[model samples]
Target: MKARASPSIIRRSFILPVLLMLAFILPFMFLRVAYLVLESSTLCSSPLDCMRLRLFGGSDSSLIMKMERKVQSSRWRESIYWHLASHGVPKNLHCLHLKLAEEYAVNASARSSLPSPEYMSRLTDSSFDHVVLLTDNVLAASVVISSTVKNSGNPGKLVFHVVTDKKTYSPMHSWFAMNIVASAVVEVKGLHQYDWSHEVNIGVKEMLEIHRLIWSHKYKYMKGEDFEFLVDHERDLEFLSPRFISLLNHLRIYIPELFPDLNKIVFLDDDVVVQRDLSSLWHLDLNGKIVGAVVDSFCGDGCCPGRKYKDYFNFSDPVISADFRPDRCGWLYGMNVFDLEAWRKTNITRTYHRWLKFNLDSGLELWNPGTLPPALIAFDGLVHDIDPSWHVAGLGYRYPQVSLQTLKAAAVIHFSGPAKPWLEIGIPELRSLWTRHVNFSNKFFTKCRIEE
Candidate 1:
């Protein structure tokens, strides 16, 4: 070489190469550290092991082995997913959801016959007893109707007044149209069918805002925190489905406004699966009471406070606690007999509006921000407790603990919580109770590819 390369030149060349390598390698090294940190805390195991213990009739080791194999095959996949995706509603499965989009598209319009607009006026025209259901979930409503009719000894003696939101009117009407309940009359109407311009309900927007804001920060409104109380489910907000949080949940309050002619009607939640004949419910006299409901399994009043209604309101305020026994127990919502004719006479709806106005004006966090607290205040002494056998509450919230015996004995099972049978997180053992009612062959479920 021309008197060998100078030492400075050689050192400079080496340093340049080193810097280039560091630039390329540093990001990879950082990523590796992050991956290690995250993997340690990740929930890598599947529910298969739990399912095995719950129902598989197989060995735990075999389940573990199956899990190990699954993890191994998807070893590289985890790295991609861990960096990119969420836990529930896996992206891989979402690819199959095209059918849902297709089914909900414009093609899915009403195919069945609906009653005349004046059907409500001719209350005595139908031979069947009437049951009213209000919800936005077309699928769940379909299940309820199908199951109710299937169990009803007299299908011809059943009339269903299905009320839904504007967007859902098509699907709701469509399903009932294609799948007629034999001789039973199925009526589908949108929430807009009712007039809300009345003076009593004109402030609905403000009332909803008040309920919405305070109810969200329930703990802050609870005054203070207790360690023991906080740790032991006292602060447990409980999971509520988005569907249950809407104005629709509060729609029960407007039954008289929605159906003017019906004297009494059985109200069923969309999540309820009717097993026994609900026609008998129409026969049960509400005894002139405005509402007939089962005891709220989880809420109560202040003076007798345990849980339930008391927990939902800020009883600390004299406005809420005064004469409104925080200790007075409340009732459940799922299956109820609403005497609209009777409710129309009382100031119950007016009282409901008054409280809603109070809660809004003072920002008092009055009753829990939901439909129930207002009902509790409005129907304080008007509710009549029916046989607990008619309704079973809390299936969706407290899953595994719910015994098969209770489910089997109940006339109606209500999944009030977020873990509905149709969702991915639904309890396997309990989902079958709902799925059995779903006609898998139905074009909607088949087109949407909804499987057990």
Candidate 2:
């Protein structure tokens, strides 16, 4: 107290403490600034609600968790399936495995077996009564074409325009060329030969080709407990099939564009078998409508057009909600009679494009799976209801529950849902109907392991 400290010493002491405090505070301040800058730069790729929750939001977001779990589940299931299939634990390899398309082309016997694809170009002339079948499933195509022609009372009148993608063109052509259906003229053409679908249209095909690719956060329309429910649920069992079967399955949508010169044609799906004359379908009057299709199923009163197509789309968007009614009855797509002249008059293609584009831009808010919903919308007012007996659906999903009487009565039976008659999953008893059409005696059949 008696001796006062020097000014330099006092100043030195104060400076030391201040410097120490800054040293401790500066690092923390820098760390906080860095964190804020990093956070502000974070951007979400998709506008989906899940993206927002995952990016800037909370871990408690049930939607995010559900998506994660669902993805994990699919991966898990796929791995288990692969493991079993690799070990030959699977009873039917058809469902579990797929041979490379080139493999079919490689077999000498298979290549030698098909009928000439030379008649493929004749579709443009409209001189013949054509039954158009567009597919890449050579096996299924063979069965369907053979069955259709075999069941027809007049096989010579039947002309099958089997259109496929470029990669499949040669093999498909070969298959048909070798296994010539008696009196039925079969034509095979690649997608490249058809100049109808534009570049943008090709993109649609590509998108479908890659749909199973990282579903990820692209589709995030759900929230809360509902998200959890969808984790285990496959909305439509057919949703997964399109990824592998994209090229063939979606070709049905562009039938009018594919065959520009044809006025009227009968379109058959690859999964279908004809037990009666489909020529009768061509004879039925469409009443000026562009499409003739059978109703999917009867409703409470057993009326036609019972299935509501609108249910497949997301009506939450103002664009979709304003344009479509969720209660409208939907039609099926297996065997359709397309009136090309009438179709050209309508904006079915344009409508299909517009809706398809909107759905693409809107993150596929239209249909959850497959190409049917777009066709349903595109052919909305243009569908003519044929007799229900002409096409029998639900054979795939519920074969046992199907009335044997009804199945027998059907002119055409569609393995519409998923359990295709050719797959191991198909009902053995029901499969005999489709198997009868396969040429097991053909060398291609034995070489390709296309077992009966």
Candidate 3:
């Protein structure tokens, strides 16, 4: 200061420290940006997770985790509500229900005598072809029966056993009674008609309660947690939604007990349309396996590339982790051949009930809330893989990237996802496959305004 330092000396003194500071900070900043870029590409597939890293600072790990959990919780809640609202009984179905109900009130003969003594006796006959369909949706059930009858090699031999809830019993009965398929015997029965044991009734009640708790996010209360979990493990809970869970889904687990007189039966979900003759399934030897189904994918046995046991089970628990492998393959439920004889011989039904009880005891942590997961565990190693061509699934969600030749060749096309062919959200391109089976000219369709 006394010497009055030169201007160049003062400038160099100030610039050197500033340059050093930028050099030190630049590397760390570059490293952080690279880390975020890599994470965004690989780990942050969820849009919400990606947004958080950009908008919210990442210095506080606890705060970041909390924000992520909150966002995921909100998303899950929104999804559950949307699914519930979208899947409610559609307007056309309600209109048909009302029209049928009114018809029943006016015409006593509208309820035709279904399953006369001859067909009633055939219900337990092992010689005839038996197809069991359980559903409450009248239009869907009609499509299944109509398509199946239309595609059968011997329609006279086909006998359909349709089971429905009491509320839809009259409408379902009326539909089958009024519109008789070509030579195919249709027997419609309400769930109340069957005599369920105390344990069976209790199991259904418990499973339904668990399904409700899961979709509503109240499962945390059942799990002893005061708040929703940080993870969205219930993403697949839609498969167990009200549309899927109803008495029909639960009834599949007890097929052996439900139809004790039958030897083998082809179980069809209402969402499927028969494109070709399914009579061959009756003759195919199950190789002594209880459940004969097409593996969900074409992947080799025990080597499905997409979903596996780990997807359906909570492997973190010691019991599940010890008992099952995560890589085991999963199969579909929409179209399956159940060998009731072999099923009864083994403890499959008992095993199913045991697992259901165990899942309930574990606060529903053993598996998700659909019959498929427990059925996977109960029927482990007991599934006989059928030809993939017999059943082609996943037609309901979006336009599947399948060839027209493949669709034409598939014996049964299943609209198994949420976007049912009857729903407005159904994929337009695929909806035709199902709607073509509907007789739009029928008086019922005209009355209910059911058109493609």
Candidate 4:
């Protein structure tokens, strides 16, 4: 101070402080910039409202590219350009894998590879707000995807892109435009693998597949979740009465306890339709029973060992010999209502597993392990018997001589014989019913039904 500080010393002190600050801040700035670039490049948003759009489902590189091109095209440009410019989507949307960890045979594999809540948190930290699951594997993928989509619906928007395999292209054509309006398209290579090993009987692999579908969809309800499990046999299902929707809604309110926190399902066989509102069936009480089935007297007597008169209901009825009085428990055959929780609690899977083991051990061949009489007798609880007013059960049109009065009263007619209405013979009433339900003009829906 006494010598008067040199200008060089003052300048050196200021420069040194400035350099130290820059060194500390520069790396952080660089890192932030890198993160921004990566997010912007990878994220994508819809052309329309960013709040409404979500991308999800199983997709390959080709399908993804195609979707990207579509979004970039002039048709979608106005709706999407701003989003693209802002790098809005990838930054705001989360991608979820539909594949299950257990199926892949790896420990914590789903946690490590598939997107979890934690992954979603980290992604959202950067800006992502929505989740979409893409998948070709229907059962595994859809189950997982639906769970995530529903759960994430509150915190962020959720969507599912059900990219059917190439073989199913024609079947989904009519719905394509509608699909595009809602979500992007993904073309998968093939349908999920179908397992035939656990089939109940020879040539009933299709039936076994249907059973699998029932279990897969109902598991959520059994686990006490609110979900609408629509168990359509296939896309070919045509509802004769448009009023079916109202019927389902009525069932939800009036018979709430029947299904227990799940959407009451309508299990339609291919050959039936409703001419009037089905609300009556939905409101019908099942007491505490878990399932409802149409009573059929013609169930193959020889098929059920328990159906024989020797297995009489009252073993001690001295006046009624075992050979004279059979346990007429009224079998729940064809078109049935399943109480998801009740069925789960009964351990149907374990029962089915035990049945399979018994059959294998005894070298017995049984077709349709779900043959109602046996299942009803074997199951722990009672099943409610619905009037034939809802279900007309028989060989489809083969019994043309049978009364249509029965058919008219029936909410559902089961074509349970060799000749199907689609074959143009069995039940003329059924053919008429099918025609009434389906619009022949829609080639896509028609084709899907035939293929299925």
Alpha-carbon lDDT, every model: 0.67, 0.66, 0.78, 0.37
For model 4, what is the alpha-carbon lDDT of residue 178? 23
lDDT tens readout by residue for model 3, 357-413 = 777677767775566787888898899999888887877654454667778889999
Rank candidates by lDDT, best first. Answer: 3, 1, 2, 4
> Which of 3 and 4 is ahead in lDDT?
3
- Lowest summed lDDT across 10 adjacent residues in model 1 is found at 298-307
Q: Which of candidates 1 and 4 is the stronger one according to TM-score? A: 1
Name the candidate that leads on TM-score: 3
Off by over 4 Å in 1: 1-113, 116-128, 195-203, 216-241, 296-307, 325-327, 399-401
Q: How many backbone overlaps does candidate 3 show?
A: 0
Best by lDDT: 3
203-243 per-residue lDDT for model 1 (tens digits): 55655665566556554644363332222432234412233
Error of 3 at 444 (Å): 2.0
TM-score for each of the candidates: 0.70, 0.68, 0.76, 0.38
lDDT of 4 by residue, 1-452 (tens): 47978999999999999999999999997886565454434333332222112223424455456445544453333423322232221211111111121223343332232223334333223122222222222222322332232233232422222333433322222232222222212222122322223432342333344333333333333347422322321111111112122222112212222223343333333233434434344445777776676544422433331134333233354433332335454453445565554554565544544544443343322212233322544443556767646665553423343465655665555555434444423345455554443334443334334311
Whole-model lDDT for model 1 versus the true structure? 0.67
Model 3 scores a C-alpha lDDT of 0.78
Higher-TM-score candidate among 2 and 3?
3
Instruction: Write model 2 residue lDDT over 338-381, tens digit each, in one string.
Output: 88878878887678767666676676655665567777778877
Model 2 CA lDDT for position 400: 41
lDDT of 2 at 438: 78
lDDT of 3 at 230: 28
